[model samples]
Target chain A: MALPGIASFLVTIGTLACIWGLLALGLNVHYGYTGLLNFGHVAFFAAGAYASAVLTMPPPEQVSQANYVIGLDLPMPLGFPVSLAVAALAGGLLALLIGSTSVRLGSHYLAIATFALAGIFEDVLVNETWLTNGTFGMNSVPKPMRETLGAGGWQVAYLAFSALCLLGVYLLLDRLIDAPFGRLLRGVRESEDAARMLGKDTNLVKLKSFAIGGAIAGFAGGLYAHFLGSVVTEQFVAGVTFVVWAAILLGGVASSSGAIVGAFLLIAFQQSTRFILTIYGWIQSVLPEPLSGVLPAIFAPLPDHPSFVPSVRFIVIGCLFVLVIRYRPEGLFGDPNEVTVMGEEE
Target chain B: MASALSQFLQAVAFGLVEASVISVGAVGLTLSYGVTRFINFAYGEFLAYGAFLAFFLSGAGAGVVGLPVAAVVAVLLVGALGVAVSRVFFRPISDRGALPLLITSIGVAFILRYLLIAGASAEARQLPVPLMRPVEVAGVGLTPLELGVVAVSVVTMLAIHLLLQRTMLGKTMRATSGNRSLAEVAGIDTDAVIRKTWFISAAAGGLAGILYGVLFAPFRPTFGFGYLIVVFAATLLGGIGRPYGAMLGAVLIGLMISLGSTYLSASYDQAYAFIALVGVLLLRPEGIRGGEF
Candidate 1:
């Protein structure tokens, strides 16, 4: 990697980390603070991304070959806030809709239901081509202040913007976690019966927590859409949901800062796997013939195919998921007692 | 009008075939839930693996006896794999409530799926079943293979019913599912029952997968995973823990998907299944038959 290569790589990684960090942060609100098992979280993210993209993109008449149906073509100043607000509202409303019924059920049921919802969202994205341009995603998504910032500076600017959003959300969540509402959320997670005995409307509290968490996730989706400069259905899959789950689990459930660290570390791990072949080649060249031959032989079982690297990554991630749950269920930063998602026998 | 009626009948015929496949799969899933009290998310992978194994074996010169023998071998092997997986990965953490078990199942599912992708490659492969022309039955065209699939599924379901109702193992399973501690107190050997249940359930799942492949050829690594939600809808609709309910739910979902795809849009086939699941989950979480297995 040259200086520019490293810089651009860092910028891209930093940008993605911040977006994922936002998602993890929101998930922490749902899973960590409220103990809601929201398995289909990518739906909210997709909603936010699509909402932002559709709101900001040029009208159908403006683009010569417009595949999508909706485009408000709002200017950046008006578009950014409106789009984000829409995203947040969309996510919050969706959470409210899903959470109303499933929040009261066992976390496992909630997980299954949410997982289905995400699948439905993906199906819609793929099938309803008129809405999201089907499999061929919409292109040339407008960025905030892209005209003001030159092409070279846009990446840096976007990275900064995403980081700030992550920070802001973190601080906001911190305050919320300490507040009475947060206590109520925790109360519901700990023991709904006990909370109900104390005259707390636990269901309402849970629903609110779910909505807030969803809103945050939706907001991150808006930022992600602008970062990518295009919204594709492939980007929002069930795998993304698992990745966010891994982040929360790795970081430590119920810890805001832990979620950020987990998100960044996971993003870094995913990115680093792309260099597996390069790393292997470097090792082979640096070592003696015997050692190089032995190393290649040892790692020969591991895929050399670039296309298969993603599969290897997922296999590792899946292992991590099982290992984390089996050995360190509370995660690195979480107190075992504070974690109630995996509570008493159902 | 005649064409529309034929189209409707055709959908019904196709729906019945789809139902047969789903019934086996759903029953497999529900059986585990009944005994072990956790939905094995990797059950779909069991089905996929079963189909893949059969595909490999049948392709490797099994000839006339190849498909049936391969399916039997695959089912038993996958059943054993299921037992081993639960013994190693699930049984130790089984005490940690259903939520952790559920999450762990998801992990197992991911591992199994990706590993399949790595080993078999991501490309779709068709099972080596000769294509047969569709036979018209009262204006509805049904392939010979499709009728065979339905017949095999019905036989399997009947066998399972006998296993659950008449056999000592079935009695023990029912007792264990009803109340684990009580069954233990009654000296039923709940662990053995559970192990046996796992084998049966996983075997059924594998059988279902093989049938799916036979009817719907050219399946990828994700074939079973993609069909998982629809199976879920069926399981939930018939009632989660009841094998009979699963059969009912499978029939309903199969019809819904087939009819909806024909009438609405082919692309939204799975979406219709999801809608059925959501409706059941919301309107009647307990399912049609809400009680004991």
Candidate 2:
């Protein structure tokens, strides 16, 4: 496959990085700040994506071909924020329900419950054909200012919009964390017993953080839908959670700017490595036979192998994760002192 | 009414088969979790590895060994592997919390799962075993292979019961789980006990894998990964860290999944498990055997 020009690639990857930055920011608030170990974060993300996609999409030309709840027929700019709000509300409500029950069960059980919930969410998306189009996904999504701006210009606008949203989320979280409410959340994470003794409603504090995080996740998902002009169920796998987690952990837990840096780093690494495969094929083609023969066909089957790319990607990421977790838990952009895990004094 | 009773009975029997499979994995999970306090998400990977290992052992021309022998070797090999992984991966970390350990296990899970996909064929492969006649008892049909799975699971559970209840090592493990620092003070080697716990846990997981692979033909490397949700549900339902509770939990979950799916759409089997899990957690957060856990 011919590679896209550098500009298109940058615009595409940069937008995704910003979107994921928003996701990492949300997770940082939940896991890093409030100490909630949510294993099934994808549920909220999927909820938001579906909410926005269904809300903004124009009805299919053939009604029999597609069916979904709402089609406001509003322009892109008008629909985007509305859909985003709807997504955030869906995410917040889901989080509130799960958090209220799961947090009371403590961290371990809460993690398992959330993981199960995520699985159920995936199943629902696949089976609820009327809603998610049964895995064909929503392709009719209107981007923010797409009609006026044209495709390339539209992408540029999305990149800017996502950056603005990321900034807003970061500032909102930074302010919240600096406030008394943030301290209460930290107290809940550091020591529940101590927080309770200090007259803080620890459960309530945790619940609040989780719901806020969920809202942010919803917003991020909605933004991604408009950016792509499409939303698919496959986009909301548990792996997405891990990828975002890796970002925040790598960038530095709890710091909002670190979330962006970490996301950029992750997306850059993945895209660059994918570029390696393209380079490999290019080299094989341009090497002019005899030199290529001398290079020893060690990767002979790699081009044809289906699992090689994803497996190698995951293996590299997993090894990096292990290494970071072991030595530099503070991450590249984070303060050394603000590791997400509690009860460990270095 | 007669048909409904028969259907219920059939569902109960099918549930028993699933419960036995779940119980094997849950025992190992609860055992290690009791001692170490980390929910080993890689336990699912252990199942995958063992199942694939058994497939490799059964002489489909490329196999290193065959069944019965393959089964025993798979169990022991996985047990040893469990200790090795814990040593290399988990033992070095000084600080312990649910998040760090949970995240690490997720990494392990990723590596093991993809490693299988990369090293071996991603296509589904069944354990090369002879076909057995289906046996009927009280209007419910059971395959000879399913009977073998039940037998193997029961034997392993019995062995675990004996090791935990009768042996000195078992007593020490119990003590360590009951109160680790106290057990260490009383001259028990907590590290050794923890290692032993991992071995037992992984071995049980392996047994479950082999049974599941053999009975449930056309399984891919992701076979165990798919059922991971159900496994966790059983472990949580039984109460984490309590083997007996895990057993009861597995039975309950298995029955619920089988009967519920039979009545409902089969596609929603995993969802049913989650529903049961949430309901139980909300109604009785402690679980039936939660106190012991």
TM-score of each: 0.96, 0.94
lDDT of 1 by residue, B1-293 (tens): 99999989899999999999999999999999998888777888988998988987786434444788888998999899889989988998998888788878888888988888887778787787888999987898888899999999999999999999999999999999899999999999999999999999989989999999998888888887888888899998998889999999999999999999999999888888888888788888888877778
Query: lDDT per prediction?
Result: 0.86, 0.82
Model 2 regions more than 4 Å off: A1-4, A60-74, A285-304, B94-98, B130-133, B290-293
Which candidate gets the maximum TM-score versus the true structure?
1
Best by lDDT: 1
Ten-residue region with minimum lDDT total, candidate 2 chain A: A61-70
- lDDT, residue B249, candidate 2: 94
**Model 1: CA > 4 A from native:** A1-3, A62-65, A289-291, A301-307, A340-346, B60-65
Global fold similarity of model 1 (TM-score): 0.96
lDDT of 1 by residue, A44-75 (tens): 88888888888888887777567778888878
Docking category of candidate 1 = medium
